[model samples]
Target: MNAEPEGLTGTIAIQVESDVVTSRQMVRKLTRQLMFSLVDQTKMITAASELSRNTLVYGGGGEMRWEIIERDSKWGLRLAFEDHGPGIPDVQLALTDGWTSGKGMGMGLSGSRRLVNEFELRTAVGEGTCVTITRWKS
Candidate 1:
């Protein structure tokens, strides 16, 4: 895990071996701690699990950062997954549901994007990939 600065409130970080089962468990634990509506929590958990698996399988190994956001009575969760592996060469095609660089079913990225309220991805051929997902309570 990278060194994080002090006093990062409402933040949780977890590192899992480059394995899908462990990654999914990590995401499930985090999602359970988030104070979101039932539906939103389920959606975000599924998305986070998928992204976590992708990071482990495709990006060698990575870490996930989770933060809680609260505004008035509304609450949300923000998750960021960063990986240092063979970066995506063509992001556009990768975003397409049926397209994949590996032997994956090719639904991870696009499916996760659809489940989140806000999604952002950054990647380069040699550089790593960073995926940020936010889900808000409604």
Candidate 2:
């Protein structure tokens, strides 16, 4: 993502299933405001949904932070999901497609990374996890 978050764009807590849904809705609205294409909107919503679910389940719930960033003349949406659950033991293995730590298809990490222009994952055992991703408006 090219944009730098400037203001309070939005925020959602991933404590339950409903919050995950709300997170998707909020991102959809933000993407629309940024004039994201339909495809991009879908990608963003899907990515948000996946991250939110991950937080609720594996991370034992967390928070989702959204920001409408601006860089130079470009605009983008940035999302940061944080949790203090059992941090990922092997970040690299987790990023491998179809490699799951639990009962899942294992796309939550790698797939989400591919759906956006930028992806960053920070995790430590017993510490927490934070995954930030961004998609610039094209």
Candidate 3:
């Protein structure tokens, strides 16, 4: 999360609300470029929006890094939301549906994970957090 993951295609700072919207747009463009279906595009965009918002609100502003990757002749989009704010203390509690630390709808993290093909969360108390998600193009 510190050295900027290899093969980063782009990055968007999550400092303001507009940045979240921008992140969604970027993800949409990549999804379309990868020829993902309409439903898959929506899922990736929604997950990007939620995670980007979390990077802003919960992480107190961060950056969303993206990459286009390939595996076994299949293409995929990988996104990482990294932040340096106070890290999450309870990963399980945070991932539980209907559990929220603030006024959110309590589905950001869990829902985002459900929308993606792969989800990874790394956090350290007093350090920071990084959430990486990937969706393969079928």
Task: Please give, for residues 26-130, the per-residue lDDT of candidate 1 as tens digits.
Answer: 455555555455777678878887888788778876777767676686666778888888888888888998887789889889999999989999998777899
Better of 1 and 2 by lDDT: 2
Which ten contiguous residues of candidate 1 have the minimum total lDDT?
Answer: 1-10
Q: How many backbone clashes does candidate 2 have?
A: 0
Candidates sorted on lDDT, descending: 3, 2, 1
- For candidate 3, write residues 68-95 as lDDT tens digits: 9889998999999999999999999999
lDDT of 2 by residue, 51-82 (tens): 99999999999999998888889899999999
* Model 2 ranges off by over 4 Å: 1-7
lDDT of 2 at 46: 93
Q: Any residue pairs clashing in model 2, and if so which?
A: none
Model 2 TM-score is 0.93
**lDDT, residue 36, model 3:** 91
Superposition error at 36 for model 2 (Å): 0.3
TM-score against truth, every candidate: 0.79, 0.93, 0.93
